[model samples]
Target: MNKTFKIYAVIFIIIMVILALFEVNKKEVTDWRKNFDVNQKSPFGLFVFNKEAKDLFKNNLTKIDVAPYDYYTDKNKKPHNILILESEIDPESWNKILDEVSKGSDAMIIANRLPKNISDTIGFYGSKISYENENVLKLTDKKYQNDFIKLDKFPSGRGFSYIKPNVQILGKTVEENNEDQANFIKAPFGKGKIYVHCEPLFLTNYYLLQSGNVKYAQSVFSYLSDRETLWFVESNTKESSSLLRFILSNPALKYAWWVFLGGLVLFIFFNVKRKQRIVPIIEPLKNTSADFVKSIGNLYLQEGDFHDMMAKKAQYFLNKVRLDLLIDTQNLDEEFAKRLQLKTGKSAEMVNEAIVLIKKAQDPYASVMKEDLARINSLLDEILK
Candidate 1:
């Protein structure tokens, strides 16, 4: 019973630990996946994602993807339902659109500039104006005025107002050059309607959070709700397109492989050609015996025991000389006398005296009277010299 209980308890603890780890991993995955959703729609609202704006009118309207103004000429293909949104709209885009509309193709243009040639197609046009001051023209026509509601503030931060007219003002500009105000206007192009708004913020997620902006956005969609509207919101810049292409080209794999190869070559070159540190060869001291005798002598001199230190040094030097002269110390009396006579060419008596002094100095019991270091040094100099 005890064994079973312990096993169950251990299993339970393991399961809890595993669950905690899993929860941490799950949170990381969720955070990593939280990116900008371009297709996310507002709940109970008409604002769709910016990327999906073109498809908003697909059911009721046809979409015409107009290239830049420079690319469009009279000979270019024109669609029945045309919308123009360019970074800079030139006379060529206007001419092509106007020509298509004149040919009975429904068209709308969202641009900051109005072509001098296509003035009749524009219901309202202005270079720049303040939208906040009540200086705006109020349409007395009930039909037109009923469709629009004046906004107190424009998304552009200028004091200008927004013309929230019906869907006909889809791409039209109700305000201009006012930094604070946004404009929405609509006009008829043949049997189709053209709506234009000066501000692009209405479609963005940031501006959609504004109080009345969502309503305005929905109203814009409501205008085309009757027709198959093709909303075209372009956010692609040239730099962004190039970056996207580079990222999708699998550059990491190509560059990373080359980097690895280069690193391997560098590693091989350093490992093979680089010199290794040599172990230092320490030679033993050559004159250690001499150094030891000199150190001991200096110590005795400093202590004012010059006679004792000099006698010790003399003894060590004599022993080394005896070894070099091949003198037999076993028969010290006779052999030492003979070898001393041969090596020094001295009489036996003199050599015996010197030998006696050396032996007595080495003896611990021999009474060699202390003297000043200078006197002892002079005696050693005379004997050695």
Candidate 2:
């Protein structure tokens, strides 16, 4: 049943994806973006542009997706062209764009934001966004000065002012205010001219589907020559080592990457290195005196040091006699032997015999016999008792 459910889920997902691929929203509104992704149908997305921008030029038309620096290096002279950058371009790319433009080529940069260098190069200013409502662009074109080119369903334009005299304000977006600030600008810099549009949402699918909006887009393109290459500078074209971008570029692989990352973190967290119980420190049993004496006896027997062992035992016995009985053990004489006999209450003959055996064992070359050692132990035990 589980396998069958998984199979059904896979089939359902496939069907949903296929439906989404072919689906079109005919009456949907309010989806807007200043982005140029063709997959999106947002106000500033390139879905409409990708479909219609090629139609703007039929003869000698070339559309390339290359950076400004690459374009500058490859092409000998920049042509009368239209460049649409949908995001904030870096200084290097902006400089390259200016360099190409100043060499007699015309460019229309459609962006909501510009790099500071370019903004300073062109006098740009902004007022507080007082209008939250959708807006339409009012064209104040130099070519068509008397006529008004106004269209609706465009995203609300920002209120901004610009330096004039040398700068030509070509278009203004009408919002809640009576007169919107200049959102479209045409200016001359160095050897050529540049046209900048602040409201890029006009080129999106949101308004292009509106009546006469596609024609309005064409009219905007009319400012540039139809003979040159159209470079569509995509968003985030700057050098960004963005993992999010990689995941976004591969929809199917995004889930796989997330799973792998989560699994790895869990493996590190739960499967902690190696969980062995703290093995108790079982210290070996401490050596007792009996064991120590036994060890020493074994060593003596092994090395044939029986005479040394016997002398140590006799010296220990004499020390006990002097300490316990208060008897003089300085000399093993007849007087000492008589005193030991009285203290032990053993016979005088037995005491004298034990003294002789101990003296014989004390000699370094004396052969130690077990029976003789036993007799000495008996006498020492009697003295101890």
| The candidate that achieves the highest lDDT relative to the unseen native structure | 2
TM-scores for candidates 1 onward, in order: 0.35, 0.56
Give me the overall lDDT of model 2.
0.68
Model 2 clash pairs? none
The parts of candidate 2 lying over 4 Å away from their true place are 1-44, 47-84, 115-117, 123-132, 140-154, 175-177, 227-234, 237-306, 313-357, 364-385
CA RMSD of all predictions: 17.9, 9.3
Residues 1-385 of candidate 1: C-alpha lDDT, one tens digit per residue: 4564566457656755665566556542212121223433333122344445544554454333344343444365534555554234556656655665566555545444455445445555344444343222223234444333343333232211323233233223344433323345666666555655454434555445555454444455554424433323222222344654555444444444454566567556655665577889998869988999889767875787545775665665566565766555554476766776777666676666566666666666766655433444444344344
Top candidate, metric TM-score: 2
lDDT by residue (tens digit), candidate 2, 1-385: 4564566457656755664554433344454545567656656677776677667655545555566566566567645675765754556767777787777777788777776667778666543244445566767765554333344544555645555578887777766656667777788877777888877776777667767666666666777765675665544333347888778555455645665576566545544553465799999987698898999888877887656766777888888988988899878899999888888788888788778877887777788876666677777777677
Instruction: Evaluate model 1: give its TM-score.
Output: 0.35
Each model's lDDT: 0.48, 0.68
